[model samples]
Target: MLKDLSPQAFFMGLLTAFVGFASSFAVVLQGLKGVGASDAQAASGLMALSISMGLCAIVLSFSTRLPVSIAWSTPGAALLVSAGAAVGGFNAAVGAFIVCAILIVIAGLFKPLGRAVAAIPAPLANAMLAGVLVGLCYAPVKAVSFNPAFGLPIVLAWLVVGAWKRLYAVPAALIAFAGVLAFGVDIPEGAFASWAQSLGPTVLLVKPEFHLASIVSIGLPLFIVTMASQNIPGIAVLKVNQYEPNPGPLFATTGLFSLFSAPFGGHAVNLAAITAAMCAGEDAHPDPARRYWAAVIAGIGYVVFGLLAGAVTGFVALAPPVLIQAVAGLALVGAFSGSAFAALKEPETREAAAVTFIVTASGVTFAGISGAFWGLLAGGLAMGLARVARR
Candidate 1:
């Protein structure tokens, strides 16, 4: 392992961790808060997720000698945002998180279960994810409306940098957001004291509260999105790069970490889709076998960032909510585009997919269930009827 270490691998590893964390943490924070977490609880959740995913990545890379990157479920967080507060609030959400983690573990251990998730119509799954993202995707424009002086620069930074180098665009937006917060936004008197107090990291162990509504609304959708958008794609990326580590154990390992973190208020952790490409690609190292070192280093980097979760969360907390949301929106544009394209690509399923997308994006709630579950249900019905008509 020592012999495999190289400067290129180290740099790529650090870059991957930095990009992965900086780009979408606001989404995570917002998701936690959306599900009724207090500021302290949200910070704890963020810290728990960061540390769990980081350790999962490290253990997997070292054990399998494959660049298996783990990350918090960004799409799952987006699902929470759409779901709003759970019927029973944060504790209920935490219970749902645990249930999702257990399901992930079961999927890994049981072949049929994993296959069942994979068997969900691709169009419906993609459409559902696309719908979940709609509200957040509108944040940039809304931010501009709220305060052009504060929001325009962030959008411009993302656009200009994205045009030149797509990967760094969100980070650029994040930096611009920081600039706006520091200079443009008004700080309430005594905010400095609060910010200072928040700098020290804290973790709270939340007791899980099981509620059928939360399980249906948040848990089930979170599990599906994490599997479809993150875990499955992550494995595909590794395979495309010619590394074929067994997926079952890797999924199980991440699920275990998710379970461990749930009591600390974290949502699901799963295989990283985007950053996995960075660690598995040739850019990490010319030799494929040694690329695992990059993932290991990236894991280390994530752990370091996890330690600073308090400060990061505190700083962002002081910013205007729209500004922070603008950054989150910029971070997810790529995901939204990809999921939307995938959902609509197949002519046969296009109508059903559209139904799913519309329903999910509507952000409707009925009988204590979020639209995500209903969207999938409606799309499935639409698809079934379409098939029957053809028959």
Candidate 2:
């Protein structure tokens, strides 16, 4: 096992954790807030997610012997931004999250439900994930335009390191981004000290309130997106890399963890898409069998990061939100490119995939449901029509 501990895999794992968290962690916070979580609840949510997903990653990786990295459902969080507000308030949102979690657990345990989700055409799944990421990929460009002095240099660092060592590009960009935050950003007085005072993990329970409207309007849609957009694609990502692990427990694990964390401000935890590639891809380890360690180390990194999340949240408050988004975009370019390729690769599903891509990327929401769900809806309709015409 120790022989597998190469610097390449270790650093790549670290990079995976850093990029994964930095990318859209702000969205997690925003979604929690939109759902009506108090500032304290939001901090608690972040901490719980880091710990929950961390343990999940460690458990799945060791048990399956595959590089299975779990993540908060970013798209699910995106749903919360609009749905949380629409459905009522934060407590209502917590109720919706609980319902969604129960549904995810059900989907995982039932063989027919798992098969149905797995049956989502590969092209459409890839396209939906690509669409979700493409919008995020633009953050660095926006960052540069918004703050060239900082963003431009980070881009240069990423490009240079990417050219030199492809695996390290995102990590280098992250390091540069962190340096800028460390030295350049104006952190408010006593932010660190105040955060330090509350260094220990705190779980804030929002006793879930069940409402029928919320269950249909918020919970069902949230489950669909998490399963379709995050978990399904996450499995696809690992499969394409030639790592096939049982999906049942993987889904069940994340669902249960999401359920556990919902009261504490965490939104949803599912299989990771972009960052999973970082740990499972060739860059993580030349020998695919050894790549699981990358994920295990990533779990460790998450645990440490979660412990320090209180301080990080304080700094996040002190900094410009856009910059954080920009850094996240930089981290995700590789994943974006990979998903795009997979989405466009097959001719049979090409048109349907394009529909999925466009609808998801458009960020259109309806009836408190996100574009991801609609993207699948639109793409599925188009795909079904195409199949009928062919038949």
Whole-model lDDT for model 1 versus the true structure?
0.93
Across residues 1-391, which tens digit of lDDT does each residue of candidate 2 receive? 6776788889988888887776567667766776677767888888888988988898988888899998888766655654446356667778888888887888889979877876878778767767767766787898888888778877888899989987577667767777788888878778778767777765677777776666665676677768887898899999999977788888998999989888876778999987899999999988999999999888988878887777667666656766766656666576567767887898898999999989988877676665666787899999999999999
> What is the model-wide C-alpha lDDT for candidate 2?
0.78
What TM-score does candidate 1 get on C-alpha atoms? Answer: 0.99
Model 1 residue 351 CA deviation in Å = 0.4
TM-score of each: 0.99, 0.80
Model 1, 1-391: lDDT tens digits are: 8999999889999999999999989999999999999888988999999999999999999999999988899999999988999988899999999999999999999989999999999999999999999899999999999989998999999999999999999999999999998898898989878888877776899999999999999999999999999999999999999988798998888899999999999998999989999999999999998999889999998888887888888898889898999999989999999999999999999999999999999999999999999999999999999999999
lDDT of each: 0.93, 0.78
Model 1 clashing residue pairs (backbone): none
Which candidate's lDDT is highest? 1
Which segments of candidate 2 are over 4 A away from where they belong?
A: 1-27, 30-39, 60-69, 74-86, 190-192, 210-222, 228-244, 272-297
Cα deviation of 308 in candidate 1 (Å)? 0.9
